[model samples]
Target chain A: MIISEMAFFLLVTGALILTVLAPVVLIGLFIKDYFSKSIW
Target chain B: MTEFALDTQTALFIIVGFALAWIAFGVWLGRKNKSHEDFALAGRNVGYAFAAATAMATWVTSNTTLVAPQLTYQLGVWGMVGYSFAALGLLLFAPMAKRIKQILPQGYTSGDFIRLRYGRFAWAVFLVISVVYAFGWLVSLGMAGGILLEALSGLDYYIGMTIILAMCVGYTLFGGLRAVIATDFIQALIIILGVAVVAYWLIDNVGLTSIHTELSHAHPQLLDLLFPAAVMFLFNNIFFGLGEIFHSNVWWSRALSFRKNVAYKAYLTGGLLWLPIPIVTGFIALAAPQLGIFPASADMIGPAVASSVLGKTGAILVFIVVFSALASSLDSLLAASSDLVTQDIYHKLIKKNASDQQLMRFNRYCILSLGVMTWLLCLPRVATLGALLNFAGAFVASTIWPIVIGLYWRRLQGIFAGIAMAAGTIVGLVAYFWIGFYVAALVSCAVSGLICAIGVVFNKSQFSWHQLQENEQ
Candidate 1:
């Protein structure tokens, strides 16, 4: 029941990629909210 | 004396500088808070960006940054993956958040809903559970701050703990929920980017392939997907997380604070963003064996590894990131718990005719008092971060079924709900002491659910949903 090396690599790398995208999405939302005057 | 990653002076400088900056930011945000509603619920009109960030960041707590790595070091792959399942709590709460907004549009705390929906006995039971879990979490975060500073920079535990507690209480006193959320947005960014850099460094320098090979040869259990203890821990951790979010005012206050249409999407997005974080933090511990860096205690593994690999620069980075992580949740808890005491206990119980201005003033005092109480409790160090949290798991998990059923079902009566929580908590504590921390939440949730089912089946009266619309004095 050992996790394969490929699985381990994929888990960490996929998480990293998603982690990288978080700031982009958050800031983009902020910009959209700022323009719309909806950010309270 | 043990060698530290950063010298004491630099750590103190970073702490003082960040403390001043955040307190100033809080004061700036406080300018618009004209009423108790504005201070406690961010005017109950928070937007998607800040709402989403606060949800994500507050969830990221000492547990994710500190305990995730510690669990990974102790339980292997399952620990981190199991930790990530906590995101399910946030994800599932999205719909409930929407329901809460619709049901209790003017709700101040989770206590309001419980008291209105289930009456005094159930509300009393709920407040007890909430108080126990809140203090458990508050003390854990406080201890973690001291532990982290001590571990990374050779700072005194007492000083570090006091400074972090005072800093959070100071800002929360100034700005309330507005300060908590705004600071959380920035802290969220620092935490994400900090961990990403450290993980990337590890993968580049240590190489995952080599690290995996080392684990396979030396610590095969870490790579074992079906490791017995880890498997047992999986569901318990999920239940613990569910209970934490489901019953705590931390999430509920956020729900009430966000704009009409924002709670669901904000929580969904926050949960999605939060899902990968524990994995990134936990992966740091997997590299420890290869680096031959063992920590004095399991909880120190994350900081110890990062500081050792990246040297002085990394220590500062870890300090700032961890500080931000601790503060994000610490301030929210301070504000949320204070709101619980002020709105639920003080206004509803003692000061029924208190004005909005008076409530606002009392809430600030509550925040100050909670900080001092937490500081005094944290002075003793007590249990390891993980142990203290899991103990709270027993108490909070019992409220899970009661809260869920009370929300959607009409047949569950207040008396039965109160009994369910009380009996479930008793049984759960029995299991926690007799079995293990891994089984506490599972056993508690199960017992509570069973009682809720019986109550649902046998109870004759239907609850009117309109009762939740509690009017302010």
Candidate 2:
């Protein structure tokens, strides 16, 4: 299977952007958890 | 058997080189292992980098390569995009990293929480679903090992399977989780770097002009953002992945192996890094029309493209990446499965007073026994890899709500939790042969949630918030 340059760029760029942001999102969750007092 | 353009001997040499190098590194890591804690959870010392890499690597498997493409081909663009929702599992689990390390500060297995928080019946219910889900997962890896070997090396499936399972089980049993995690980090690196390199190479070779012309003229479905399977893929996959991680003790037990700070860092990092996998592997299949190689099967596209693009050497690299993926994933499954059996089944049932020393001794046996059972089960064709795995997704989706609610909902009674999981699995299995996964998860979670909600509203049993406490966590 082969993808077009535009398609590949779109997919790879999207994936890369998400990958870069994954850590930031997790960090945000970590901070939120630190302050929360729910039962879970 | 499929014939790649690459020479078999060269491929073998390259793969052997990588495996031998990683095995040596992993063996060396295990030499300092002294305690059961060392054996099971890497003495709670793994750093964020190691944890993050292993988690990401393990979750992205042949499925991403095999199933993702099939979805793209059938459902169009939305299929590929829908699958991306699985990353939500890792993202949701981000805060769970801290909670697990904090609440189960001394916890060893997912089963530990059940016993302490939900009592014997709840523990028993959780154990059944977990074992079934885990065993199914182990079998899929074993199946992948054999299928890849047959595809790449023309080795007989059984011979390929036995060798793969034995090697994975041997190392994990010998060095335990410590060995598994170290090897996992390196394997994760190979997968990430290899996929990145190939994705770039393929794009350069194919060129954008030719691709757009070819795909639009032939498979215009590739451009469709929302296909008919939209609702099913979008919601069910996210729910399925989340349920698997949240309910099974496998991940937390693995998490506990890392040092507290490291575990948190690793999960956060792993969650993000894991985001690229589905696109990398799945999109390769999407490129099929331009390569003049229509994918006979979604799973075969990765190997085929590697062979076609980079010739024999690239094919060999693909093999190594897949092999590394299978090994990394299988070893963890073996380690975690055996840990559950030892900690839940044996300790709970056979030996109530088993000492740490005795437990460790029994755990070694559990590792081997579980490995053997899974090896036997996975040896069969079990239909296609995609179908077999989807079958599992349906089964576990039912248990998701019960687990999530049990963890967080204070009023969820023990009876409600236990009944919910049992009834959910039973109903979900019924849905499997008849309906789509989205319908199954939705129905099952609803069934379980309703039971728990009813218990909360009308039951005379004392509802203690302590049943699912936030103590220290």
Candidate 3:
């Protein structure tokens, strides 16, 4: 029942990749909102 | 006491600098809030980005930063994964948020809906649950601020706790929900980047493979998928999260505040963005044993290990991220709880004829009182962050069935809904004391759900959706 190292690596790395993309998505949305003047 | 990572002076400097800047930002944001609606619900015109960011950032509380690591340290891999499952709370609430905005277009708090939908007895019960859970969460966040400072540097717990409480109240008192949402956007970005940097450092420098190999050799249970206690913890955590989001005014207020057609997508995006965070933050603790760093308290493992590996810079980064996480949630709770007291109790009960100016002023005073009350309670350092939060889980999980059923179903009578919440919370608390924290939410949810099912079966009247559309006095 132990987690394989490969599974462990994928979990962390995949999470890391998603975590890194969060800022990009958030900023892009902010820019869109800012241009449209709807960020309130 | 122990060898500090950043010196006390440096820690104090960081606190003062950030506190001043955030308060000034709060004042700047307060300029647009001329009406009670503006202060309390951010003009009820919030757009997608800010709504989504506030939703994500506020959910990233002391629990995510501090308790996630503690759970991972204690319950192993299942703990972090179980923690991430909390995102389901937000995801599930997405459509419900849209429904809330549609039905209660003029609603101020979750208390409003409960009162209108269920009547006085259930509203009273719901209010008690809301107050208890709000204080529980507020105290935990306050304690976490103190704990974070004390863990990183040699800062006094009392000073650290007081400063954080004061800063949140100061800003929230003036800027209201507008400031809370605006700051949340920036804090969301800061939290994400900070966590990413720390995790990346661990991977680049320490290597996850070595960390995994070490855990397998030394702490085999950490990788055990079938770990018994962790398996039990999975469902309980999910229920706890569901209860928190479904029942609390914090999420409801955001749903009320977002502009037309924004609540659903905002919450969905926020949940997806939030799903991976606990994994990133929690995995950092798996490296603790490999680094030969054991903290005095399990909750300190996140900061202790990060500081040990990345040194002073890492300590600073952890401080800011955790601090932002604390403020984002703290201010939201303060504002939301104050809204509950102002709109639900004060305006509805005490003075029905109060003007907008009076309501706004009273809301500010409520924020101040809540901050002071939380500070006094946090002075004792009653329990570890994880324990205190889970204790509230029993209280909140009791509200899950009542809230969900009330929203979509018309058959549940007020008396039965009241009985359901009261019975659920009582059983949940009994379980928390007798069995353990892990089963409290599960037991509570089950009891409440059973009662709600009976209520739905026996009740005979259909509630008009028009009842929810209460206008301002």
Candidate 4:
């Protein structure tokens, strides 16, 4: 069953976005963690 | 005409070959086991590649080979894709690894982290849930092994299971992490090559056109690369995988086995490497429709379907792959779980002054006892694979947030972390027996996330950044 080209594009785009965003989220969390350190 | 004959012989060869190599490697490393720490965590000097491969190989056990294809048989395209979500477990571990190593660089087990990160009340609750989770998982693999052997060798399930479990436990009991890692590298290599070969040959035998032709009408959903069911399961499967790796001693021990720098890259490399295995190996079951061979259980789809397509030879190849997969994982679990006993339960509590040599001796004895317990438990094969595993999934989901959030959020007070873990576990456990584990996990994750967020919001006290940097030394 051939997925509609439109659906194919959507899924591919979604997966690609996730793949890229996963690392970004990790890095972002790390940055947040770094800044939140105790002042003392 | 014997079923899985080719697979059996081919598998036997690979098993013997890998075991021999492992024996050689074990002998070289075995006597060097100077302490329980050396045996269990490799003195924390393992490199990225070894850590990554062992982690990937162990996580992708019989379930990937069995359940994933079974899912494909029914859920169609979503089955393998849903299973592929497991790779997220490895990828998600990367950041979690760095944070965990920083906070608890010398941590011995998952229990050790929970002990330091939370309170005894929470740790006790976590341990009960953990024991059940570990046994549930061990039994799932056991039941799968029993059924697989029954199918291939025509041997009774009990006999077949004993053989497989004993072989794995035997090697693992003596070798420690060094042995587990050495064998795992070989096992991982064999499994990868075997899966690729059968997949290539499968496409050749049935051809993609025929597969599409047969699958299009009977189960058109299989053809839809991203069907509705796949999307529905997408997030759940991801959480399931994440929960298992995130909270378990299995992954934590691997983290502890590596040098600090090696730990991070190992997780990253392991993540990327595992991404394609589900797609590569599990899709062969799509060819099941072409053969019209539907085993009563779907997890059996990979072995049965592959055997039919490649004939006896393919069956044997699968057996070898399964052997490698099972041994690699069982050994890792045995070694890691024994480490837990040595560190968390033994050295810490019973024998604070125990020399490293004395501790190593106790570890081997613990390995023997635990092996017997898991063996006796596996004898029954009580629950269906999916039900048993989903229940185990709930247990881990209970730990995920406390683990993930607690790692990054040091301001996380022990009380809040304790409440999050305990309350989430209570709710999840209640849901599992009353409702189902998936629902339990869903509720647990949501509730635990809220509790953890509340802890963050309140900010009673915070850990200094300098403390973490200093601890790494």
Give the per-residue lDDT digits (tens) of candidate 4, residues A1-40. 4555355334433433343333343334334434654100
lDDT of 2 by residue, B1-473 (tens): 25745454654565456556655766777676677777788878765555676777767666665566666556555666667677777777767767777667777788877767667887888888887888878887888777766666666778777767777877787778888877776677676667666666776787546666677788875765544455466676776777777776667786777666666666666766776777766666667767777655556656666667877666667777778888888888888888888877887788978888787778889888887898789767766676676667755666666656655655666777788878877786677668765456555666777787786776665545443345313
Tell me the tens digit of each residue's lDDT in model 2 across A1-40.
3344566567766775554454454445444544652101
lDDT of 3 by residue, B366-426 (tens): 9999999999999998789999999988889989988998888888988989999999999
RMSD of each: 1.0, 5.3, 1.0, 7.0
User: What DockQ results do all the predictions give, each relative to the true complex?
Assistant: 0.94, 0.14, 0.93, 0.07
Determine which window of 10 residues in candidate 3 chain B has minimal summed lDDT.
Answer: B464-473
For model 2 chain B, where is the 10-residue window of minimal lDDT?
Answer: B464-473
Note the residue pairs that clash in candidate 3. Answer: none
Kindly report the docking quality category of candidate 4. incorrect
Which digits, one per residue and each the tens of the lDDT, describe model 1 over residues B211-246?
Answer: 999999999999999998898888999999999999
Tens digits of lDDT, candidate 4, B164-189: 77766767767788778767766766
Off by over 4 Å in 4: A1-40, B1-24, B224-230, B429-438, B464-473
What fraction of correct interface contacts does each candidate retain? 0.93, 0.19, 0.93, 0.09
Candidate order (DockQ): 1, 3, 2, 4
